[model samples]
Target: MNAHDRHPMTVPSEKRTAISSLWLWLGGALLVLGIFFRVYNLDYKVFWIDEANTVLRSLGYVSQDVTDTLLTGELFQAEDLQAFQQPSPDRGWDDTMTALRSSAEHTPLYFLLSRLWVQTVGSSIATWRMPAVFFSLLLLPAVFWWGWELFGSKLSAGLATVLVALSPLHVLYAQEARPYSLLALMTALSSATLLWTLRSPTWNRWLLYGFTIVVGLYSQLLFTLVAIAHALYILASELTIYKRFTPNLLRYLIVSLGCIVAFSPWLVLLVNNLAEVQRKTASLGDDRYSIGGLIDRWFRVLNQMLIDRELAGWNFLLLLLAIAALVYLWRQAPRHATWMLLLVGGVPFLALALPDLVLGGERSLRVRYLFPTVLALQLTLGYWFAATIPTKRIPQSIVQTILILFIGLQILSNTVNAQRLVWWNKSRPASTYFEPVSALVNTLPNPLILTESKVSDLLALSYWLRPDITLQAIPDVVTLEIPQGYDPIYLHNGTPETEATLQQQGIRLTPIYPVNDSVDPWLWQLEFPL
Candidate 1:
């Protein structure tokens, strides 16, 4: 054989294997760090307004009898009702539970699951919020899997996962009793699965993708933006990358069509209920923080969510690395990265931002909304870091040094944030009104009351105490005065000025309970003696 022909042109299997091992270790370390951060204080902030709503309704739904009674505004027993009518400054569980069961306004899916969870865990705030925590934890693995898929390197994927795990914005939502984190996990899985299904025509994968998309959509209406993004991404891919129409595209279309068909029922209900939902949503005032204000707030959000709070000074460092990664992959990744970025980030943001422009702002910059985009950005960045950087004209030592520095910064930032999470979770801030009202329910039977505050927590409390209550805004309850001969136990959460007005109407305002006395502004519960 000629000398030129005898020279080897392939990498040794051992070297390739070593490289694979290195990436695996990098990814694993990142995954562990991410999980630890997200899970540290998951139990803290257990019963925010939204969560209370979810928990209460879920509890009511778990027991068909309770759910029925709750829905009918007759969840309290006769004895509880009589006790609620007594002259005491306080009535127990009866009043609170009855009010909540009858008056809460939110969707039922998450709440129903919450009721089952509370039954299993005794309805403690920590226990009630555990489900959200668990689901939020799943996002790390999803991020890792997603990153690895796009970049074909565990190292790159792990880096993305680390970014997500340490984000302050993500932690904020993860700490709450909401479905945004679950929605994020579903989006990551659905998008990854859709990519795989497109490349390989497997019915099971296609089916799984469809299921994820449907569940995500049902979980939150905003997922319609995701569906729109995916549709656009597919169209772009077909026109640009694939070049010609293929059987796989048709299969994808059919599967997507099937998903749309499955989602029809919920879609119809959403359409029918649009007016009610819109009215409630529109009541929120037009309050814009200006373009500069929006940018500044979003910057802080991005910083906390994409980098560690403690190392925020080093955010610029991390940003440079991300920029380097993108620059490296620019030529090879223009199409795929652009499409993924547009789908995951560009579209939903525009959907959210556009309404703000026309109607001013209405509290729309939630971190979880950008979860899909952040992950995609990581994957695209990772691909750039791994594939393009190594092949560039830069020196080998310089490239190695840059990768090591970037990864090290990410690890340091994530570690600091994980520790922060532990501290935050253990520090549970006490609420003023809920505990007192909950205690009062123990004294009253059919304790029907209305509160100036939101209704979800009260409803959840009723579900826990098994009371027949109808809770609402005073105006709402007054508008529905039933001929059933019942007077409501009113609780005021407004300023002293409003309390004085209620007192003038012969309603007695009692001192706030000790549990939340320090925090309560309305230092009295309105007594309605039957």
Candidate 2:
């Protein structure tokens, strides 16, 4: 028989099915292991500053409908003030709420959904972090599906899923209250949809792409980087198919215009609040780094993002290898090269870093700026695992083994980091601090003169509690105004000028109730006769 007519010896159907099932089990096991590493004992750690803010705002949003309505009226102007409230308890319904409230700086969609979630699961660390965890979990399936469709190989799909599931960066955000994990999932979904749209190219598909892009962008501003990368890929893909660029250019413009129209509401707010936003950027305290500092900071951020911050040093050898792997892939194919340049490196690096220089070098640079770039790097690595498989020379098992080894190394490094860094900090989760502050509002009297430093905490608490108290931010030296019926109680932590000013205005300076220590004290419950 001719070569085309003859069929190679094949395993029985049941064996093939068993083999397929085994692979699925392996992928599921890897995913479970990844999630466990990220989520196990998650609440044992303390809340980072940003996490505290998110929890405080979230509580304010869900518990205080009116407060959320008011805050949304001005793009969350109460953000700083609201953060003054104490941390949430990380317990039941109230706890879930606080975590969500603290995280309200971004779009409302995720937090809004989180409100519903908290209503059900309650606000344990596991529950609060589950949304991001689940989203990261969704990414594994998405990577598998994308690989299968793009390369028509189940091996490639399974390998990619394993790589993504085992990635340290994916695990890091997966355990947080933030939206980066969701953003990564959305990117995968959008990419998958884009691939399907290319095959079919229907109007519905185009609209689906548009909607997905809008949702992704709304989820996080970093998604704009994802869109930029996709746009370049689409342009290049079209050039490949049509052997020309003009008609594709017009089509891209139409699709892009649609995205702009959909995203205009956010764009308008972003533009109008540019100045206020710049001030927020400055609060990060990273503007003065030299180019060397920037590079060092960039890699350090990447390290924290990929593995746990504690495990960062342990994985230095692997990080160097990962960098080399990226270089190798870029050299291998133009598609990989374009993606790394445009999507992974180009957009996030320029957008975050250039803003400091362009906005007059006033704002501080931050690690979060590299979020999109980090996602792109994860995707690049997945694609690289698919591309570098040696078909004839090396056994397929050997190829899979090598990719799995890389994942194993990353996980090992992260595990070591988690033991060292996360444990040592004994970080206080958002709930612990926020709930007490929220409680203090009920205990304290009206006409409360909250020091300016405490304004953010109080505003966050007031948004949730809405205790009929007169609120004023105590700047360096400011008079406290009391209404006719109520007496004014000055809340001071050794700011004599502030206290004297309040006293001159007929307010009493008394430290009746102090929870924490001197440097950063808690609410002062001074008596006020009605």
Candidate 3:
């Protein structure tokens, strides 16, 4: 009967429409920006030491392999490593797998995917790194989906997507020939999948949850830790009477069984190589970490994620402010606090911390291990931005604008450096760093390199400086001989033992041209007294 009753909420509804449209465009722009960032100079790096492993052992995509043979080193026959120590495209699939299991110590999913990809496209540096870029893109929508689930607001989810897109740490891994980006992506999906199972323990959801865990494990060994995080969430949810425990509990057990069955093949191999695996992983965390060291490591990784470099000057100040805001968020949104912490932060923290306290290696120093933790932080910040009631005094528009501006600043920090836009920090891409080496080689008239085959990645060397140089291996450093007529003799990451033996053999080498981040220092001409 009243005029006010006819379309009473029209104005407010229009305002909501406008805000939603603005955020949708803004988030879409950010996603586009991320894609552009990843594609910028995508092929700017040759395979470096770690990447060489991916090419040679993981995928067999390269023309040759530069990895070394296994320690029981003398099995140089049919099952001897085809790509081991010296990678030639001539090696077979079995040989590559044999070398991977015996030495590389990685799962075959990424590598197998890589194998199929390169077969179709023809392997090149760009082709090799394309998978990382693909996964990096997949993670974008995944970030938005998870963020939306956490905050139930497009603004929050969009903000988180922009941050994940512009993350320097993630960007670095995205441009490499490695599985870290996949690990980060899988971690998010697996976590979400498990949460979905708990929320609705249907047959389909349980199957998906189990399947995601299997893929996550195949992606990265560290992903198994996420299982612990899921269990913790389930226990906490049950303790708080959030979910009942009958069929869901049984489904959870079945899910666990499914994951174990799926991962059984890799488990068998892992058990066989348990000693080698232990020896290799033992170097990750050390028992000697002081409280100061732990804090420093945590802070440094945060800086790396946002800045694409270390914290300093105004950037450091911004990071501090961000930390304050995140702390505020933790207080305001405790709904998922326990789950987020246990899933993304606490389990990882304890896993690394316990190893450092009990084991003797420095495992937690590597920032890559904390990718999931950073994801959780980003989600928390997203939720804090989306809240309708907690900070009602502050206008939502201003809050959204401020958070968006802060994320923009982070993007600027990473993109300001042309190199960091593609990888990490001011450190040049592998291609850029090796450019000088190639330029140097071009100037040299017929170069011969004498290197210890195992230590030097000749595949990388050949990749950059090919055809003009001949690489010779020195089986015994004691019989060191730089043959006459090789003109300039370069030692590739020569060992102390080799240098001493050369001196004992009365061979003097001039350290004429030395390269940074190279397999070895070159010995050209001869050493001259200052």
Off by over 4 Å in 2: 1-25, 55-105, 120-126, 149-151, 239-251, 284-286, 309-319, 331-345, 355-367, 386-405, 413-530
lDDT of 2 by residue, 91-189 (tens): 455554444333323654565565557657776555766787778888878767655544445654676677677777676667777777788787777
Candidate 1 — worst ten consecutive residues by lDDT sum? Answer: 1-10
Give the runs in model 1 whose Cα sits over 4 Å from its true position: 1-27, 61-122, 242-245, 283-285, 308-329, 384-451, 457-492, 495-530
Query: Candidate 2 local accuracy as lDDT?
Result: 0.57
Residues 334-426, model 1: lDDT tens digits? 344446655776677777666666676744465556666666666665565555333445675777686566556556654564444232322
Segments in model 3 whose C-alpha atoms lie over 4 Å from true places: 1-15, 59-92, 242-244, 285-289, 313-326, 357-360, 388-405, 416-433, 453-456, 513-530
Order candidates by lDDT, high to low: 3, 2, 1
Kindly give the stretch of ten consecutive residues in candidate 3 with the minimal lDDT sum: 1-10
Q: How far in Å is the alpha carbon of 32 misplaced in model 2?
A: 1.6
Q: What is the lDDT of residue 120 in candidate 1?
A: 61
lDDT of 3 by residue, 1-530 (tens): 10011111122566667767776897678778778878777776455656656777644343223323332222122122223323346766776577567643577778767766776787677888899989988998888776655544566667678788877677777878888889889877877666555555789988898888889888888787777787667666665553556666677788888889998988899998899887866656434667676656656666775555554544555566556557656555445543554467667756876666565445565667777777877776665555531245567777767676667766775476435322432133433435555567557777666655443245554556645455566666654444557556666556778777676666676664453346445433333123
Every candidate's CA RMSD: 9.3, 9.1, 6.5
TM-score of each: 0.68, 0.65, 0.83
Q: Pick the candidate with the highest TM-score.
A: 3
